[model samples]
Target: MNKNIDNFVPAEEPSKDQPITVLMIEAVGKCNAICGYCPRGQGLLGPETNTYITMDLLDKALDLASSGSNHAIYLHHRGEPFLHPKLDEIIRRVREKGFYTFLSTNLISATPDKVKKVLTAGINQIEMHYSAGLTRLPHEVLLKRIHEIRKLNWELRNFGCRLEMNFSLFGETREIIMEELSRHTYYDETLYVRWFEPHDWPSLEKIIDRGVDYRDCHWYKHKACAILSNGDIVICCLDQFSHSCRTNIKDIDRIDWESLADRRMCQGCTQHVEMNWLEEDAIDMPLWLTRKQEIDTWTA
Candidate 1:
């Protein structure tokens, strides 16, 4: 989550003792974009009402994770994360709690004020998610927001939050967009771009399949944890829209930290080939997907 990315070893290198490096808290569960390949595009998100995860709930999750190795929280999953008005405040609190934080947003809804506050809010990293070289807004408008963010060189370094771009080759002709976006630099730091194929992400069935080769499992190698906006704690980012969660944040006592890395559930995700489940996090609709829900049924 944070740029400090600690000890991500090869799958064979780490013993079972590898630390759970990141914790995902979906503070906001709504997105401004409706990318067709995403769960939201397929109409499969959690409840629309009361979608913001309040500070109290967040603290509970943090309290549960207090004893873990590398206490970093990836701010959210599958939504325009900045939709929450108190995003800066949330990041500040997480930092105060002795945890690291990062955000991945579409930046379609970003404004100059929001950008400045978020950059200065003690967040360690921020990433812009662009699919087919565009967010929900026109490329021109998206460029304007990028301009807004890039101009904050001082805030970025002062607060420790640097920027990066994640381009999904899901759209037709994403090359031009990637080339255009990569041309810009942020705070003397190159806007590192991570490219992944949405089609390459394995289906839930394949991801859960025990037969998928262990070598293709870079995604689950470095363990991570996740808590939904509504307070439920799932195994990892792959369960973003799935209800097969271990427990809710309120029920922190039931957490099984050691069992997180034993994620046969995440075996096949490709993590952008490694399926870096850390940066990517998703879902649809106003209601949460049930444990019995089948996302495979809703496809392009």
Candidate 2:
């Protein structure tokens, strides 16, 4: 008798009538850092094996832009996005189509000059990933770079943009870091902490019953569509949806969402370690206790 549990699949809903607003564009194939937990981390899959989505692929995504309410594009999907030389050109093209755009940069190689360039090119928001206060500089020299960029003259602020920090917590003193952040007074800036969940080993039972709330942050699940460089459209980034959740753009006008969602493309997909899936009221214990246990489980 086969006793292996099948993959976790979310409840299906009605098909979408319009295009999802947010689209994740993977612009580059290489990264400057070598984090241990990254998909392109220092293991079987490194920068050598990574491939980037080209301008032609992005053109297709623009053609398929959601004709819905407000269309927003998020750069930096798979690897570090700064590696793309034509990043500014890409942004210009997106804006030319009259769509709002944002970029999630790791801030490793992002210099003040590059920051200014993107801001000038018209970036509405920048979602920066910071590992830790100052100690995690090995992940990338972002902490130092961010400090310098924030101090730019008032002219830089006029680009009309907001900066948000997103940190990945593995094993750290949350209170201490939070206090440090408070002391810095990021000037009412938002700080988001993402819990680490390994893709190779997903906690199914725990995640479903007492884990983080994956549904909350998942805007893509509700509407957005992700276009890979190969012209394959993915529903979400985590599910490894090479099977059915993805559809090739041979005929963009004739996409059949009914059959795509029903396919086993994302059968056993669950949230990642850095992604918090539980809401405050949904968990049994306080936020700290639950988050601590999540870290412990990953560490163990």
- Per-candidate clashes come to 16, 15
Q: Candidate 2 lDDT, tens digit per residue, 1-300?
A: 111236625435434565443356667655666555454444434334356667877777776664533445666655666667777777777767766566777777677877766666666567676752232354224555666555542365442455667665556566765666555434233434544333442222122334334333343344544555455555545432233333565446544453234323333444433333211211122344334333321110
Question: What 10-residue stretch in candidate 2 is worst by lDDT?
Answer: 276-285
lDDT of 1 by residue, 75-165 (tens): 8675667899889888887877776577888887678888877666666667888662264566566666766777773434432345677
Residue 97 error for model 2, in Å? 1.7
Per lDDT, the best of the predicted structures is 1
Quote each prediction's TM-score: 0.71, 0.66
Q: Any idea what lDDT model 1 has?
A: 0.59
| Count of clashing pairs, candidate 1 | 16
Q: Cα deviation in Å at residue 138, candidate 2?
A: 4.6
lDDT for position 251 in model 1: 50
Error of 1 at 44 (Å): 2.3
